[model samples]
Target: MEFIFLAAGLIMGLGAIGAAIGVGLLGSKLLESTARQPELGPMLQTKFFIVAGLIDAIPIIGVGIAMYLIFVVAA
Candidate 1:
């Protein structure tokens, strides 16, 4: 039980950090792409947002699960 919470915490924290870094790098390139193609700014921005949603999905789930384990299971 203790190890489960510890592992979940580590996974959630590291996954969130990795997701943040991935999103930052991807967003930077998305910005560069938009700058290079002004007319496609809206389209590219939408796509970037979609990608951001995808990138966040797992990390958010991990966080929620970790919280559940910590509060409910640990309690």
Candidate 2:
């Protein structure tokens, strides 16, 4: 039972860390690209938001799975 909690924690923690790193790198590249081509800033911003949402979905899914483990499996 305790191990189930640990597993869920690990899943959520790692998922969050992975998403953070991905978004950080994505933002860094977006800034670099926009700086290099200011005229394309708007287009780059649009793409960045789309990709950011996709990146964020990873952690949201992780949270849902974690909840399932804690409530359904552990219970």
Report residue 34 deviation for candidate 2 (angstroms): 0.7
Q: What is the RMSD of candidate 1?
A: 1.9
**Number of clashes found in candidate 2:** 0
Question: Per-residue lDDT for 26 in model 2?
Answer: 98
- The numbered model that scores best in TM-score is 2
List all candidate RMSDs to the true structure.
1.9, 0.5
Listed per model in order, the count of residue pairs whose N, CA or C atoms clash below 3 Å is: 0, 0
Q: Lowest lDDT 10-mer window, candidate 2?
A: 26-35
Across 1-75, the per-residue lDDT of candidate 1 in tens digits comes to: 879788887979899998999999999998899889999999988999899999999798888888888888878
Candidate 2 lDDT over 1-75, as tens digits, reads 999999999999999999999999999999999999999999999999999999999999999999999999999
Compute each candidate's TM-score over C-alphas.
0.79, 0.98
Number of the top lDDT candidate:
2
